[model samples]
Target: MNAPQVSPIGGLPSRGFAEPHQNKQQAAPKNDALVQIRCSKAAAKEVKRAAVEAEMTISEFMLVCFHAYMKR
Candidate 1:
């Protein structure tokens, strides 16, 4: 009987992760529609500042906020 082989902790790929597919033209995004929210200049500046502080794009920040609101 052969001794059992030990697996690495993470079981990650040994040769490195596969590269992203090349030259695959992506279809136009279906969720590209924009829903504009009008706010004061100061409010907009604060939103931008918050997004920067959170290390996220403005769109990502807004989506996070939306999800949080929906959760509540």
Candidate 2:
């Protein structure tokens, strides 16, 4: 006979934990239009300054911020 498995957290069965997060994900809809954003002169300048501080290019800095902002 097989011994019952033990949990690492909350002592709950492992199978019970996985599905809760999966169920909360939103379904994607059709026809999603991306917003076109124009960076203002001040914002552009800020990105340039940040890039200089990080020893990177303005485009690279903007890419980093774009990814972080999209994630949020």
Using all chains and alpha carbons, the TM-scores for the candidates as numbered come to 0.38, 0.37
lDDT of 2 at 68: 66
Q: List model 2 lDDT by residue over 1-72, tens digit each.
A: 999987567675555444546435555456688745677999879877878888987678768877967886
lDDT assessment of candidate 1: 0.75
Best by lDDT: 1
Off by over 4 Å in 2: 1-35, 57-59
Error of 2 at 57 (Å): 4.4
Candidate 1 Cα outliers beyond 4 Å, as residue runs: 1-34, 68-72
Q: Which pairs clash inside model 1?
A: none
If candidate 1 were superposed on the true structure by all CA atoms, what would the RMSD be? 10.1
